[model samples]
Target: MSMQITLRRARPSDAEAFERMMNRPEVHAGLMQLPYTTADFWRARLAEPGGPAVAELHLVAEVGGEMAGSAGEDPVGPAVRRRHAMMLGISVAPEWQRRGVGSALMAALCEYADRWLGVLRLELTVYVDNAPAIALYRKYGFEHEGTHRAYALRDGVYVDAHAMARLHPNPPRPSPG
Candidate 1:
């Protein structure tokens, strides 16, 4: 039997499950997350205000009524010139890794960025050792631009990361006079 996956905007009510998923040993190992993330932290983050101007999107994936994964996009910075660019982050439960959960989350994020938000650039960094994640991102059109040496510390050792990005495949065209 196949699992049914659903995607929706994350809510404060999902704080507990979100925290659990992010803190899982296998899950946090691949992400930049530190151990012991609290439910309160996720609650506050999920409840943060957003609007048309904010352009922030956080989505959770559910399967069999359980949190399977989450993905999001945040503006690269506060500068007006950077409005067209957003950074992406995603995480899937260890059991859900090989499933389509990650793909579903990526599809929704890309759709929102390209169609509704008028975003032209989506970017992310992944540790070079994470081949599965790198393949997934490439499947979604992310191209590696460069590498960052000692980008972050994980397990008391510095790790390198690949800077990947995807530009809008079909940017809007201005009306002809």
Candidate 2:
């Protein structure tokens, strides 16, 4: 039997599940997140208002009413100059990896960025040793820009990362006035 995967805007009610996924050893190892984050932190963040001004998006993936994964994109900064770009992050449950959850989340994010937000650039960084994640980003058209040596500290040791980005394949043109 195959399970149907669904994607939707993340809700405050998902805080507990989000917290659990983020704290898992297999999950957080590849991510930049620090373990032991509280549910309240997720709830408060998810409860915040988001729209064009904020240019922030958080999406949750569900299979049979259970959380499978989550992904999000946020403007690199608050400055108007950076509005055309956003940084992306994603995490999938251990059991759901390689089961199309990541692809579904990436498709939704790309659709929103390219079509709705008019975003010109999307960026992400993955640890060098994470081959699966690197492959996923590459499949989404993210090209490696450079290597950031000693980029982050995970489990008490620094690790190198590859900075990757994807530009809007078909940017819309402004009408001549």
Candidate 3:
């Protein structure tokens, strides 16, 4: 059976749901974030507008009127030299996994990056063992960049991560003076 899900920009009011989603053991296990994430953290995150240049975008996935997942994009740095490059993060509920929730989020994000933001490079780091996520990223054109040993601490033990990225075919063109 297929489930319908909607994607929209995240708002401050979604802090609670975002918190709950991140607190799931399965979700946290795959991420570098520690357990016991607070709603206030998400609240503060959503409360701020991404700056004049839209250096970041946070999107929420809704399923049957419930917040099912989320995806975020931010720059690798604040300097002008790195403005065209960005980093990505995504998370989905256990129940929503393998059910198109991730695909929707990725699609929305890639569309925004390509059409709206004109980002030249989108990067992400995923656990090396996360086959599902790796495959999903590959489906969207991200290729393996490299591996980082002890890239993050999950559940109190160091783990390796694979760096992946998708370089936009048409990078943003410079404005003529």
Worst 10 residues of 2 by lDDT: 48-57
Mind giving the per-residue lDDT tens digits that candidate 2 earns over 37-148? 9899999989998766777899999999989999999989978788889999999999999999999999999999998999999999999999988999999899999999
Query: Per-residue error at 128 for model 2, in Å?
Result: 0.6
Q: How many clashes (backbone N, Cα, C below 3 Å) per candidate?
A: 0, 0, 0
lDDT of each: 0.93, 0.94, 0.90
- CA shift at 54, candidate 3, in angstroms? 3.0
The lDDT, on a scale of 0 to 1, for candidate 1 is: 0.93
Index of the highest-TM-score prediction:
1
Candidate with the larger TM-score of 1 and 2: 1
- lDDT value, residue 118 of candidate 3: 89
lDDT of 3 by residue, 96-149 (tens): 999999999999889889988889899999999999999999999999999999
Clashing pairs in 1: none
All models, RMSD in angstroms: 1.2, 1.4, 2.1
